[model samples]
Target chain A: MLELDRVGVALGPKAIFNDLSLTIGPGESVCLVGPSGAGKTTLLRLAAGLLAPTSGEVTNGFRETSVVFQEPRLLPWRRVTDNIALGLKARGIGRRHRRARARELAAAVGLAESLDCFPHQLSGGMCQRVALARALAVGAELLLLDEPFSALDVGLRSDAQQLMQQLVQERALAMMLVTHDLIEALRLGHRVLVLAGSPAALVYELPVTTPFNERTPAWLHEAAARLLRQPLVQASFQPLVDREAA
Target chain B: MAAWVRRLLRGIGSLTGVLLLVTLWEWGSIRYGSFMLPGPRDTLTAMGRLAEQQALLAAMWATSWRAITGFALAALAGMALGLLAGLSRTLGRVLEPVATVLLGIPPIAWIVLAILWFGSGSLASIYTVAATTLPIAFAGAQMGARTLDARLAELATAYRLPLAQRLWDLYLPHVVSYVFPALITALAVAWKVTVMAELLATDTGIGAGLALARVNLDTAAAMAWVVLVVVLLLVAEHGVLRPLQRRMEPWRTGH
Candidate 1:
């Protein structure tokens, strides 16, 4: 479990967020959906204990947490298996045992064949899968993903999302993901939260408790229509869609 | 097979350049007269003469050993200080000025102080070389460390990578990239300073041999020593350093 209680963060002269708070309970999948510069990534960093808030407190109770960054962030020097093994290696697992475990994780992520490949040699989607595999290899109770699927092709993104859904549910992993894509948030998250405005605060929260892996197109459209009906969520969409339509 | 051909052609191209230089030297020798500027042939003959006496090999060994010893020490000190400075803002602020001051001081100035302290042995040469080269490695390390990906460090911290694991997996690879070019530069400076120091202070290395040749007015022998020094530098950079770099960063080579 992770909690950011009434957090305030100001970088230089600009304030990113004031009096913002969030909590991700055990086995909870919370997706943060926001405008382009809504400090979603910064919020994730705050929860990961990477950045201390200008005011207020963050309490994280998870024994282990792993993050999949926007970029794959694999070591260029390491092979796919080695990169996956990194968290285990850091946890003092032996080389032979970690390698075996890494291969297993790679298989779970559908990257077993790429175990010997370098990051540079892999396709973008494959690289993202490796990043996912790496996070899973940490055996962390909490997984934070920052647009990890944003760069992939739509079909690949769906596949990765399915893998993520399966694994998270199977392991009962708590997760916080940041994304701008409404459909993705709706597709994968148990609950979706939105932020808007310059010094943003949480504006809307939607709970979509349908079994995500089994959700239909009709369910998605109905949820989208409902999300669009939220005054604050609709307001956040106005500036971008109105300008694009004009 | 294609790779081999490309490699062979590259080798041939390099050899051709060397041959061209040798031919130009021969022409210059004929024009200037052998006494003033020896031909490559005359330099080779003098090398053989010195080699027969075993003086050339001994002097070469002496100079190379001193340079290498100093280079190794400077690398250790410089990299350690560099990492310290990069990792700590206060240390960076303190050391930046110190490294700048050291860099500003000439190696020749250090040679005088080194001789005064160590009294004209390899110690003076070795110390002068290390003192002159430290700032280069230090600067490289600092820049490398400063620019390292913050995300990588964050990942390491989140994973609770032990200090040693962070070092081996993350910090060292990044630091080494910066350290390498500096090491190459430091090596060149080490050789130059060691010889200059030996010319003034010691009597056992190639620098002393060159000094003796200057006194006897044997231009070819002096030229031969110059050739040997250049050869040693080439061998160190190409033979040892490059291969070591390739071994350390095999991932960088193909893709």
Candidate 2:
């Protein structure tokens, strides 16, 4: 289990998040959805241990934590296979074994043919897939994704989401995905949390039962739109809506 | 056929331009009737005489060795110092100003000081060349180090790449891009400054040969020596520098 208890973060006198708490049990997928600058990214960063909260603690049961940022962040100088092998190499795995593992993961992600290609050669979707493969290869029980598929076109985005669903199911991984797109949240997340207001607070929590792999894109989009029209979510948008009405 | 002919015409035009300049030079020399303005024919004759006496070849070899050795030393030392400075802010702050000052000083000033310390020989010339070239290498390496992608470094940190792998795969590749241009510029400066230093503080090398020609009032031979230096620079640029630069730009292979 991964838990964040009363997490508070202040950046240079500006509170981005305060008293924020969430938990993910084994094999559960959670997504945080909110407006831009909602501290969704910050919460994910905290979970990954890439950032520390000003108040409150994050508890992790696993030895490894893997994060996939919005950008692929692949090393430009390294080939795709080598990039996937990065975590293995870091853990002091033998070169031959790491290479084999990287090759296997690359194939699993449909990137086997691009093993020798550099990051610059890959398309945005391809690069994200590589990033996904890299995170999976790290064997982290908890995966933190910060808008990992925000750059992809619609078709590729659904394909990547499907791949992620399969991987999460197979590995029994706990994940916290941060996204501004409600459809993405509805598709990939078992539960969705909303972050809102100044200093950032978790305003809403909703359970989503639609199996990520079984849901059609249309179904996900409809559910997502309906959630956006909810009293709480619409009320959060009241200021802008009122100004437009006037 | 049209493309080939156009290329041929462009080449011929360049050659004709050079020929026209030479023709003007020869005509002026013949009209002036002065040794100072010796014609191309007279310079070439002087070159032949020097070659026949074997002095030209010996001088060329002496100058070349001093410049090459000095450049090699400067490249090695400068790159090491640059890496040190780049990796540490304190080291950069302490050494960078000193390097800037040393670089600002003229080669002639270095030659005079070198002569006082090492006496009038190739040692003085070598020291002068190395002094002039060191800053160029250091600045290039420093820029390379500073400009390396921070994201890549963060990735390296996240992955926890081993020391050896980080140095070879990350640092060295970035360094190589800076090293090539630095090496070329430093080598060129080393060659020119070595000759100038040799002219002032040495008794052997092309600079000394030029001095001997000047003493004898043989303007033709002096001009011939100047021509020889230009030719050597061209040869080195094509034979050494260009090949190395091409080899370093492997990423441009397909593009």
Candidate 3:
């Protein structure tokens, strides 16, 4: 389980988050959905332990954590397999065993043929798949994803979402994904939280009851539209535009 | 096969141009009928004579060592300083203008100062070479570091990559793009400046050998020394530097 207790983050003179709290138990998946610049990424970074909160504590039971950033952060100089092997290498795994694990993960992500290809040689979708494979290869109990599929085409995004669902189910791992795309949130998240305003705070939390196999695009879009139509959602987003204009 | 053919054609064209220039030199020498205008054949014969005396080998070694040592020092110092400057805005502001001034000063203008500092020996030659080479290396390293992708760095930090891995895998690779051209330029300048410094300050090396030939009014020997330096430059370019560059940056080949 991973827990954020009354977390507050200050960036320079501005508060990015204040009095935020959340918890993810084993095998649970959560998504933070918000308009652009609602500090979803900042929240994700804190949860991943890549950054520390200004106040409050983040407690984790997991020994390992992995993050899939908005950009596919695969090393440009490394081949797909090597990038996937990075986490294992960090943990002092033997080279041969690490390569074997990378191969397995690459195959799982449908990037078997691209094992030797460098990041620049792959398409945007392929790079994201590589990133996903890298995260999964780490064998982390908690995965933090920040708009992992934002660059992919709709079809590729859906495929990646399905892959994420399968990985979560198979490993029984907890994940927190941050995205502006409501449809993606509805499809992949077991629970979705809406974040808003300056010194951003969670406005709503919605539980997703739809099964992975049973969910349809039309139904997902309808749920997303309903979520967006909430008055709090509009009110939450308004402050961002006003802040920027000022 | 087509690529090979194209490369072969380019080589042939270069050879043809050199041959034409040699032919012209021979014609001009025949018309002039003087040692001052020695033809390609005469220069080649003079080179053979110098080789027989073994002075050419000693001179080549002396000049080569000076250039190599000086350039190596410049590379080390420049990269260290450049990384500092690249990572810190204040350091860059403090040093860049000084580097620019040093770079602007001609190599010849510094020869007298180098002799005064190092006292008329191989050290003088090495100092001059390093002085000329440092700015190129410094600028290249700075540019390389500045242009490295911030996203990649953020990724590295997020992954908690260890210092060694970050340097070897990310920083080194990113710096190579600028470093290669800078290194090539530095090497060429180092050799030229070292030889020139030796000519004025010392009694060894190819440059001093040329000075000795001039004092004796042996134009052929002087020309022979010049030929030796040119040959060394070509060998270093092809046998050492080109191969190193290719090995360091294989991805650049397709681009």
Residue runs of model 2 more than 4 Å from their true location after superposition: A235-246, B1-52, B89-94, B216-249, B252-255
TM-score of chain B of each: 0.96, 0.90, 0.93
For candidate 2 chain B, the 10 contiguous residues with the lowest summed lDDT are B246-255
Residue B128 of model 3 has an lDDT of 84
- All models, RMSD in angstroms: 3.0, 4.1, 3.0
The CA lDDT at B70 in model 2 is 95
Model 1 / residue B181 / CA error / Å: 1.2
Best by lDDT: 1
Question: Which model, 2 or 3, shows the larger TM-score?
Answer: 3
Give the alpha carbon lDDT tens digit for every residue of B1-255 in model 2.
698999999999999998998999999998987575999999999999999999999999999999999998899899988888887889989989989998999998999999999999989999999999999889888877777777676566655678887787678878878877888888889888988998899888999999899899999999899899988987898898878776655443422
What are the per-residue Cα lDDT tens digits for candidate 1 across A131-236? 8888988788999999999998889988888888888789999999999988888988999999777888899999987886567768887888889888899998
Total colliding residue pairs, candidate 3: 0
- For every model shown, what is its TM-score relative to the native structure? 0.89, 0.83, 0.90
Model-by-model lDDT, in order?
0.89, 0.85, 0.86
Among all candidates shown, the one with the greatest TM-score: 3
Lowest summed lDDT window (length 10), candidate 2 chain A:
A234-243
Where model 3 places Cα greater than 4 Å from the true spot, the runs are A237-246, B1-3, B6-37, B145-149, B216-222
In the range A1-246, model 3's lDDT, one tens digit per residue, is 899999999988999989899999888899898879889999998988878999999998887788999889887777888899887887778999999999999999999998988888889999998988888887888899999988888888888898998898888888999998888888888998999877789998899998877779889989888887888876776676687899
